[model samples]
Target: MASANATQSVYLDYAATTPTDPRVVEAMLPYFTEIYGNAHSGHRPGRRAEQAVEDARETVARILNCKPSEIVFTSGGTESVNLAIRGVTLSEKGDSAKHIVSSAIEHSAVLKTLEQMASTNGIEYTLLPVSQEAVVDPETLIPALQPNTALVSVMAANNEVGTIQPISALAAQAKARGVLMHTDAVQAAGQLPLDVQALGVDMLSLSAHKFYGPKGVGALYVRDGIRLTPSQTGGSHEEGQRAGTVNTPGVVGLAKALQLAYDEFDERTAHYRSLRDQLIDEVLRLVPNARLTGHSEQRLPGHASFLLDGLDGNTLIMHLDMKGLAASSASACKTGNPEPSSVLLAMGVPYETAFGSLRLTIGKDTTETDIEYSVSVLAQIVEKLYRLRQNYR
Candidate 1:
């Protein structure tokens, strides 16, 4: 039995990627062995693989509340985002307009691709700002819409701050103006309830790793009737939307992960919220001059981001790691660089505060004891670092 004083390490970076659940592992084992086959083959082995892929696609589609035909399997979240943004822009019918609207807080995958399109393809774009709560204002986008605007891409939830966006409202606004909408929902898929129809988005992106499935597999939901140009060319696969041999095991794992996510979403959310609240409460009680980041109530259930005054986030993270608690200074994707978090900058966070940020995301396996222990360990480290900084000053 687990206890409060257990020697096991605590991992609080679920936003980066979750460990594969045993159930998902079980679901994927067969695909890797007896059922292994090329989804494109016409033989018995091929037929088995093809059917498994189709079934996985259906499972993903059902979770998103979209048709199976709308789901296109890709390598991961980056590919899905690239395909959604570039595919729509490149496939636009006319030459009169070539512009897009996205936020500054988007992942590098989305931002870098848009930047490349702007430079090489002459695709002009606008990057909107976010509030202190890290939520983008839908009204800010109204004045930016041009007749040439091909699509508007925004994240459903911020990876660093965990602030949920007003996706439905934003998508509706874009739709009313005849512009397409796409959202990078990699961080929100399993943590929140998703309904593509209700969200009113033309395209959506999700990755398996973020939801406790295997890495290197993701899906894109393209609304019916939206024309998209294929980025990769090969024989007809994924209905010619995406091409290449499908990773049968990866797809099977993703479907199982998503199914488990949906089946236990309510209970998991509640459990994580309870632990998150306990963490925040204990941290505030034990640590001085630590402030929570992101929206107080509108954030993800398990996301607990904060800034510790006068302490370098990287140093703090290292200290915590030495103490056997794993956390991140910001999004795992943006770490190891000296620059402050772009998401925090977009929300108008000062450079100093942004540099001192830490993100601790709980998960299904996290317990109150884990939160308590983590808080205790972090408090000791922060105080030591703060004293050292003060002495140097």
Candidate 2:
């Protein structure tokens, strides 16, 4: 049963970011006040801080099934992706032409970094088309690889549409050709099993804030024996891969948050799937022309997205906001842009219809009552918008 005062707006934008878990906060408090020494310093307090950082690294490495030395801490997912792609380019040591292969629906962080590298460093890239459900076929990737290809970069899942990619198969293809692979696992980290050996990727990226940790901190997993040139240079830090004074509190929070998430993965994912299914079913049933986006099953358990005829998602989101319900029309990163979602466009949705994209994601604190309230509010908004359109016509 919902509380009598449960009229607060529902937060359905977990894909964008999540509130920090209290346990993670508790773990991070000591680092902020008492043990606030630089990890690079050699004093007693510094050694203690360094120990905390190393322990946190071990925790993250254990979760990702990689060596602690392979885990490189960065600002967040964007920097992690940038470091992986840029660092790989710098390490290739090739006089030959360098090329990269990636899917069309990648986040702006990946796409924009590729664009910048192409213009500045003379690195070439190919954006492969995906299926209508936004899945990249590994068969298509083989033909795109070249002898000079430095890396094959793809996301583990679609941030907007919630479509899961066949990462292991894609990684296998890359490895057979002697090409390195990297995946932005920011969206998939807490919700999916991310065993690095099983995934068979050379590198992967994750952001702490996406999985209920503090912002401004993330980790990149580089497989043992994989060499990446340092992206940030100054002092020797993060094994000389990233150079800076480390955020002891943020890293501690990241490790604690990931530990909690890993422990409750089964229960949390099951709950999300159930609520997600109900949210999808109820909205589709109660509203006309409500088309569910992404794969029906092979998607993140907590994610649901849709398109509606004769309705723009931005306008619908505004209406829902007025009704005490929060949601997104596309990637939160691209919010307020009147343009249609590139993810929907890549999925073969018509340009006009793509403007109607809506993404709703469940989180750890989301409940059945919240789902019920969200669906009811969404149905009402859609119906009213349609009626208004009919009258105007």
Candidate 3:
């Protein structure tokens, strides 16, 4: 049950960003105060900071089933994706091949970088479309792969629709063709089990904050023996692949968060899954035109995206806000834009339906009562918005 003293309001935007866990905050406090020092400095303080960074790297590696040296810390998901794409593209092999394959529904971090490269003639890119179920067909990707295809990038899960991709299958295909495979696993990390080796991805990106850690820190996993050029040039940090001072405090918080999430994965998954199912059931029961988006069964544990006909998603968001329920129309990164969701568009949803989409993601902190209240509020807002649209028509 939500306490009457709960601060702010009900937060349903975990897909956008989650509050830093109290445990993570506690873990980070020492670094900010007593252990304040640059990881690059040459002193006891620096050594302590450097050790903390290494510890965090090991924790991240353990979670992903990769070597500690394979994890390159970056600013966040965006930087990780940029580094993975650009580094590979600038590599000797990538420069010669010049062709890349990805999904149309990838986060803008991937799409935008690929677009910029495409414009420069540095790479020829292909974006495979998704079906109405938000699943990309592996067969379609096979046809798009050229002999010179240097890399294939797909997301482990779609951030907007929560559609889990068949990454292992896709990676296997890329492997057979001798092309490297990368996956943006930012949204899939805590909600799903991630084993880079099992997934057969040559590279994977993850954000700490997405799983209850501090912001401004993330990691990229590079499979052993994969050669790539450094995207950022500076100090010999991150095995000389990435430069600049390590974010020691953020890394510590991330490692702690990752460890906690892994420890509680099964319990948290079950909890969020139950709440998610309940929310879906209530919305379908109460709302006449509510349609669930994404893979109905293969979706992320906590993601619940729906389209309410005749209701503007922005309007519904505002209404839900007024009722103290937080949600979004698409990925938080793409929110506040009037454009229809690229993910939805690629999934064959009409523009009108795309504009009517709402994404509500539950988290570890989300309670059963909270889901009940949010569902009740959403049903009411959708009905009200539909009637308003009808009247205007």
Once model 3 is optimally superposed onto the true structure by TM-score, how far is the C-alpha of residue 1 displaced, in angstroms?
13
Misplaced by over 4 Å in model 3 are 1-8, 93-95
lDDT of each: 0.89, 0.91, 0.87
Residue 253's lDDT within candidate 1 is 93
Instruction: Sort by TM-score, best first.
Output: 2, 1, 3
TM-score (C-alpha) between model 2 and the true structure: 0.97
Q: What is the TM-score of each candidate against the true structure?
A: 0.97, 0.97, 0.96
Candidate 2 local lDDT, 191-218, one digit each (tens): 9998989999999999999999999999
Candidate 3 structure, TM-score to reference: 0.96
> Candidate 3's residue-wise lDDT over 1-393, tens digit each?
233233236788998888899999999999998888898889999888888888898998998998998999999999999988888887746356898999999999999999998887568899998899889888888899988888899999988889999999999999988889999999998999899999999999999999999999998999988766777788888878898888888999889999999999999999999999998898888766999999999899999998876567887888888888889997787667888888888888888778888899999888878877777777666777778778988
Candidate maximizing lDDT: 2
Better of 2 and 3 by TM-score: 2
Worst 10 residues of 1 by lDDT: 1-10
Per-candidate alpha-carbon RMSD to the true structure: 1.9, 1.8, 2.3
Q: Where is model 2 poorest over a 10-residue stretch in terms of lDDT?
A: 1-10
- As a whole number from 0 to 100, the lDDT of residue 26 in candidate 2 is 93
Global lDDT of model 3: 0.87
RMSD of 1: 1.9
